[model samples]
Target: MHVFLTTERLGLRSFTDADTDDLFALDNDPDVMRFINGGRPTSREAIREQTLPRLLRDCPCLRTRSYWAAEEKATGTFLGWFEFRPLDDHSPAVVELGYRLNKAAWGKGFATEGSRALISKGFTDLAVERVTANTMTVNAGSRRVMEKAGLSFLRKFTGDWPEAIAGSEHGEVEYELTRADWQQRR
Candidate 1:
């Protein structure tokens, strides 16, 4: 298995077929899924047949080093996943950063740690020009993680959604960090 990146307490690795159960459990939590699917549990069949396959296909380090399965390095337990890939693979200088951790891993700095590491890799190693991330405007927790990872608030925008959550009417917020900005911060 290809291990992509590692944070102080988390290991980001390429996802494999064995990760289906861990992904299923993470997606099944109402609190974890709240911002994603409005607390609706993803079906097991979808995970087994679709989700895991897609993750495995997209996350290989050899191709893009995009999606990653986050694990607790100390215990080797699956924490969740992180994504840092270009909006278009053809133009890899601009990428988007994202993560989804289990509720159990909340408030532990894992998100920020993993994010900072990925952003560092993008700018210092991957020749990334800019990194962007977005979340529901009401998702203060995620927004905080973005801030702590050194991204600055960019804008708020509305998107067409098939399922409306409690804060969907408020739109979403975008945060970004350019290579120049990252260099200045360093």
Candidate 2:
């Protein structure tokens, strides 16, 4: 497996075709998908056709895949994935940071750990000026992770979600960290 970055506990690596089973299990968990799709279960076909394709796509600006399959460094268990994708194909100035871990990995510090690592790399090596993330305003767990990772609340707005979920009425929130802000924190 091609490794991208490693946190104290997470090994973020490039996704492989062989990860279909792991991806399937992670997406099938109701709690895990609650914020993402209102607990809808994803089919294996969708994992292969849509999810994997998107994760495997290369970011022209970074010359590497934007999404990374996150796993436990010691056990090598497939936890979920992390995204540090550039907002534009040609510019590394702004990237969106995201994470979707399995239910089993929830409540741990993995999300914040991986996020901080990615942010540090973006500011120091990836020429990224800003890092941003978004989630339903009611997703308190995810919001806490973002704050812990040093991103501040940027905005709250209604999203054009194709399917409205439970908390869609509350709208969505955006959190961001700029390179200068990150440097100051360090």
Candidate 3:
């Protein structure tokens, strides 16, 4: 059976090709994509050709990754998706956590709540050593979510970003928390 993680009001379940509309809606909001793509919409072709396949079967970048949809438990509304995966090219213990929620779900603590759960699972269930998240330097909201979820600021650096967003020039900030750090905080 397929399993999912549940929060007080949300269910995080694996995403499939059927979620195309929901995914499209989530990424279509210009406000949501401001820091990521400068308010541009993502093409459905990209989602189908690259995003879905990577989140589902192909793990060319990282192995054993799972992409889950955040469904409102009460209404079964598709809020967005959260990703739990390893970040390393060769090592799988260095897990990473990320989320992209609809505008309706923003400012509701859903991001922080979901991220905390992913971090816990990465550390306890998956026995992962590190869990991290990143965002554009200007994305204060995202940085706050990672901090609220107990990740510490790692660093800021520039890389060959595929699509240059409005704030990409400010660099990307990495926030991370190790299993040991989580344990200590607990």
TM-score of each model, in listed order? 0.95, 0.98, 0.91
Model 2, 1-186: lDDT tens digits are 789898889999999999999999989999999999999999999999999999999999998989999999989999999999999999999999999998888898999999999999899998999999999999999999999999999999999989999999999999999999998888
Cα lDDT for residue 128, candidate 3? 79
RMSD of 1: 1.6
Best by lDDT: 2
Model 1, range 1-186, lDDT digits (tens) per residue?
A: 889988789899999888888999999999998888899999999999987776776623325558899999999999999989788757668899999999889999999999999999988888789999999999999999999999999999997889899888999999999999999989
Q: What does the lDDT come to for candidate 1?
A: 0.89
Q: What TM-score does model 2 achieve against the real structure?
A: 0.98
Please write out the lDDT profile of model 3 over residues 80-176, one tens digit for every residue: 8888777665665787788888889999999988998888877787767898888988899999999999999999988678978788999999989
Displacement of residue 92 (Cα, Å) in model 2 is 0.9
**Which candidate would rank higher by lDDT, 1 or 3?**
1
- Displacement of the residue 142 alpha carbon in candidate 1, Å: 0.2
Model 3 lDDT, residue 86, Cα: 73
lDDT of model number 3: 0.82
